[model samples]
Target: MTPMNPDADAVERAVARLTAALDEGRPVAPVRDLIGEHDLAAAYAVQRELTRRRLAGGAVVTGRKIGLTSPAVQRQLGVDQPDFGVLFADMDVSAEAEVPSWRLLQPKAEAEIAFVLKEDLADGDLDAARVRSAVDYAVAALEIVDSRIADWDIRLTDTVADNASSGLYVLAERRLGLDEFEPRETTMRMYADDVPVSEGAGSACLGDPLNALAWLARTALEFGDPLRAGQVVLSGALGPMVPAPPGTRIRAEISSLGEVTATFSEKSGKPEKRDA
Candidate 1:
């Protein structure tokens, strides 16, 4: 196994190579194979290094995204629970951004009811109502997920080190009061290219967004990083993800809340298939 402190130069090379592959359509080394029998700390440091470089290149840190909040998703990844990654400004589409289809490679979109926090929720007992009290607003969000792993074949650790397949997020222009919304009772439909794909109730996301948020609170605290006030939480994917094809429009509608959409960049499209 790799030691706690992996070679800094090696980590840098891995990050740079991965970033270059993403830009130039080159094949990337599978993360699992790259870190075989290695300590997680070493692998994680590579992720941080990659994050730093992306930031230096104009990626703005906007919010954080949590993944695997659904127990079903956790079981699929063979993990106990969820993980997180910082959201870059580039990942957000402010209700006005134009999306053409083509820039993303094998993308998938899922709807989520997001919680915009008002006050700090650290060390608090977070039931549904308590989570509601901490919320300042709610918006319908679409999470555009893309896996860096080759063929989407991954273990829980590979996912963690890959930053939870972090992708684009679209926030609806229409925002509603948290108290006015029942995320648990909420239902949403996922559509791709004007075709109805799948639908789900809030229960799909770890038994409602609030319970998902509560899990995040406790997990963060365990990691020595508690969630702070004003951090927008994407409770998790509301519906089963629908394949997002380029030149196609993707959207979602949350009950009583609103809708969000994502249009990929036409000219900047990626390859249609992968070796996954």
Candidate 2:
């Protein structure tokens, strides 16, 4: 699909708009107006430009994130493939720290499995075996997704250009080897303030979390930035995402992978207490 606006100019406009929203801590209109709703190529162009700007600003690439792994969401977006976003070092917030609410707009939380690579996927068939073998370990993680678009109103292109609506991520401490557990068979249940909020199985993520990794390795290779050794890969959500408003405590337990938690700080940066 051709962008509603032209190529380079449209990408520049999209980058500028998203950058402003991030810098000012406010959401803007959907960028689909500039880039077409279905022009994934144009959408990714905007993403690359934004990544470039972040790099110029001293940000370092930490890893990558796979989004739209749910088949239902993919069908809704009219795409057969999942989209990805670059993860930066600043996005990591371990469970020990409170996630500052001031750092996000329209934040939501989802449980996922995160893989740390032990080999480069730059040259290979990039099949399931290769990607799975490259994993050094897997851990439970919480992805705090946020949108730069106002009210979280976004289409495929809009979200893609906004770095797949990335915000902060919290990782659990336990590490399990592939032989220690089966990803597709794992079950996940997320809680907000000790109340169960969302639940699903590992199969929710592209049939298996490893499948998501394989797809990302192949796509990242095709895009000229293959998954490298030591990079962390968030293999998409294991369940439906739930809104994470300020002063909320989120905890996700994934069988075999253990649990991860994050408490969203109030605007004042004070940690919120869990419900009694």
Candidate 3:
């Protein structure tokens, strides 16, 4: 019989804990205790297992989302680097007239620049210049980030294991090429119920959104999963994220990329009780 690897076993337990929280339609304690507060690899292991399960259940890989690109946020989370999470087909709520409230636990909204790639970043050194040429277009995006950890009391490992606290994303219809506008210079303002709540510029996101993409490309390549063509990449938040409670209408305007909005339904996604 093959001996069970303790670290691998810990990862499994962490996955199970998170999966249970998701299935129960509620938040749970942070998974950092199980995977260690600083074990990024173990945290990612849990995320990968969750992704595998989602794929097995027929979810398609649409793209990826970068998290913690803001220096302030990194400081808040006590992590010096950014993290990433998979973007699945179902996670795209762009077409929904009103976003379902129950689809998330505790969600916050942030504005971002979404990049749709035209070429693979699998070959050659993926510098900023190389990554820029691969972009097919850019769009304004609103990301509804959710946390499965209770009260969002999370360390870096906790959020990383919980798919970088991803929930749903909405992209603007307007698209722009690199030559049309410089990403680093774009400004952003987000509104909740038409009241301005958050604001920042493109430089808030890892100096530039393109830099975030470049980092993701290099990181993904190192992990043996180089970014591919036609994948949508949410390059990280351009400003602070605000609470997105049920029935709230959120909108974000990017100076050059245009604006995107999402109106959440009033009802929460509370699971119904079932007979044992």
Candidate 4:
């Protein structure tokens, strides 16, 4: 499932090649060997490649995304640890922004709470209170996750090598102060086109979403880039996964954080017909 290689440019080149292929909507294999050989870094290599190209194109990293933090998701990946990704300026969407559906590849919108840090927390006795104390606030968000890799057929190494399949993300406007609600006790309901798609609680996210933030801080430091003040951290998914279709609206209501919505613009195609 993995191969080791040692080319200094292997990771960067592999990322460029893969991003090019994906941008063209062409299929290609995961750059697992490139990651294994250049540096045994799967997640870091993925983000490095994404940012490498994104920066060349003049995009900036606005935040970070933590994936596979759920025990169930970890089990699915056959790994015990989670992975993370960088959030680009392109991924940020205000509450009412229209998200073009064609921009994503197999996108799944997730319901979760996002934390914006006021002070840097780089691994210490970082308790939930300290996590809360270093706060900006919380926002109800929808992460539009799309894998650049084909068929989403990937192993832990394969996915981690693809920026944790981090394609696009969108955020809502409303922000509640740290004292506004309990992060762990909050409950979330996901709606796709007004239908109840899934339901979950904040506890589902690594016991508490803040813990997810903590992990992101620690793990990203391990990956070479530590969390910095004013960095926005998406805690992870709290509800079930659903396919995001064109013209569909994704609404997520967190019991504590209020509701946030993301509208998906229909992909260009034939319009639906009216009944005769």
Q: Number of backbone collisions per candidate, in order? A: 5, 0, 1, 1
Q: lDDT per prediction? A: 0.70, 0.89, 0.90, 0.74
- On the 0 to 100 scale, the lDDT of residue 227 in model 3 is 91
Candidate 1 Cα errors over 4 Å, as ranges = 1-17, 25-27, 36-43, 56-58, 100-103, 122-130, 269-276
lDDT of 2 by residue, 143-244 (tens): 999998999888899989999989889889999999999999999999999999999999999999999999888888778888999999999999999999
Give the TM-scores of the predictions, in the order they appear.
0.82, 0.94, 0.95, 0.86
Per-residue lDDT tens digits of candidate 1, residues 205-227?
A: 87878888877766556555566
Q: What is the lDDT of candidate 4?
A: 0.74
Better of 3 and 4 by TM-score: 3
C-alpha lDDT of residue 154 in model 3: 91
lDDT of 2 at 103: 79
Model 3 residue pairs with clashes: 102-269
Query: What's the CA RMSD of model 2 in angstroms?
Result: 4.7
Find the 10 residues in a row with the least total lDDT in model 2: 267-276
Q: In angstroms, give how far residue 206 of model 1 lies from its true place.
A: 1.0
